[model samples]
Target: MDPLQAAVLQQFFEYPFEIDQTYQQGLAGILANNPSNTVLLNTRVFYFNRLTGSSITVADVLAYKEQSASASESVPPSNSAANDSKEQPNVLTFAQLQELIESGRLDEIPNNKTISGELNSAPPSQSAVSVRRKPWETSNDSSNIMES
Candidate 1:
């Protein structure tokens, strides 16, 4: 077989070349001259840089993503029993609204009209107030005097 293939098989299967042995220890010492975090490790120049400590491989990213997906999948919100009782109202009758407050289901808005005006919308007191804006200027007005 090829020499590189033989070397890889021997190293992996038999754990040969003494990961902590003399000949390999010298080689390992030569390999571990630095413990710096280098962005250039993304390139071939990294191997030449000779990292002293352990380095993270790309498999860590894939494993992290898979673990996150599994975690979120295990706790789906729709599976909760409390979800059945959390019915949202699209419409509320006057008596039902009053009962809702008494049953502690609905909280009343302060000074909101139940005694006089509409219940579904904001109070009539709002519409009664005349909101005035700036004076309307005619399109045929005179030229604006520019001051420097």
Candidate 2:
């Protein structure tokens, strides 16, 4: 495994609850340690699982990175570095990713729509009631009633 990948794994294990923070720390560490490797920096992929609130496996990162690289490679090259810069994938911030996931932009993950629908379609709950009669109170019956 790559040194950066190993470091990422270590950070994630250390702080399992802070997925985004761990990812950011890992990226910063990698960039700090190897500033010259623009390819590594630009090609990195962070696969966050919102449901589990955790980062996915390194294999997922590798897969996404490969996909991103292939997609970028297909685009035509330009003379200007600005154009190349534009071609590079924009790494999504945690907030943006969270918004997208919550907004249902990523349909691959299940959302609460189904649950809401079920709740809406279900019958309303009936409350049970207990009735009590006082000992002094008597039923209206002419035959059983005593003359006053």
Candidate 3:
């Protein structure tokens, strides 16, 4: 077993719930510490199940990492680096956007792309048509009287 794997296991066993993150974070941390270490299969499953409220085998987890690694490796390092810098889109929170919009500085943002647009323009108002209400909702007093 790798020393890093042992350390991660120790950290997990000591205070598992200390981290306020999801099971994925825990799994990522463990794997990142020692990607090739496979000695703690049971521990991995147990930790994942407790954190995620779902079952996951070490093989399943490792397979995903292996696939990701292989896929990444296929791309040349230089191209991958360039693609990473190019592919990442500018992300902003609603509050930040609202600030920009309020300040009338939206035009200052370069390469701004609309993430979404109005889908099916507000279903034409049907004010001309009357909505059918439930029998109880109607103002008929007779309907309120229970019948045998």
Candidate 4:
């Protein structure tokens, strides 16, 4: 199973009987109308069947959590190194810098002097495009297109 599923199952296994009952009831209520192929439904069904005061083995849960934690810890160092190499100082794109200059809003660009130098050195193809407005600006229109 995936780490997230394992984590959730681990949590469910560790919960007190009363808390588990409450959680099961809440899950049942949520899935009362539609009960098909859901994780919550599946978990509820499993725990319900095994609720006859039987002790469950949590070795798998503990081992899975430890393995996942170790794997995650090992992975971040390499990812952080790659991210450090890729990191660059924040700078406005050529188009935005130009727009700010034309609209007399140059002050809006943070570290403008540094950004301007970088933008001037970069090719025209690297410029950022302005955002376009959506066709439907407001949701108050009462007319239905299906009526006509």
TM-scores, one per candidate: 0.15, 0.22, 0.27, 0.20
- RMSD (Å) per prediction: 26.1, 15.7, 13.7, 21.5
Which runs of model 2 end up more than 4 angstroms from their true locations? 1-79, 107-148
Least accurate stretch of 10 residues (summed lDDT) in model 2?
Answer: 43-52
Instruction: Please give, for residues 1-148, the per-residue lDDT of candidate 4 as tens digits.
Output: 6565565656654555334546545554554455433444355445643763433334444466466668778655567446433432234556877898899997797544634444466656865887675775434443354345
- Per-residue lDDT tens digits for candidate 2, residues 1-148, read 4666555544443443323555545554454445433543342334234323445565645554455456678643343345435433345545766898889787533222434444476789886876676777677774376654
Model 1 global lDDT (CA atoms, 0 to 1): 0.38
Q: Residue 31, candidate 2: how far off, in angstroms?
A: 8.3
Clashes of each: 1, 0, 0, 0
Residue 35 shift from truth in candidate 2, angstroms = 12
Report how far residue 56 has shifted in candidate 4, in Å: 56
Number of colliding residue pairs in model 1: 1
| Residue pairs clashing, model 1 | 34-52
How would you order the candidates by TM-score, starting with the best?
3, 2, 4, 1
Candidate 3, clashing residue pairs?
Answer: none
RMSD of 2: 15.7
In candidate 4, the residue pairs with backbone N, CA or C atoms under 3 Å apart (3 or more residues apart, or in different chains) clash, namely none
Cα error of candidate 3 at position 30, Å: 22
In model 1, which range of ten residues has the least summed lDDT? 35-44
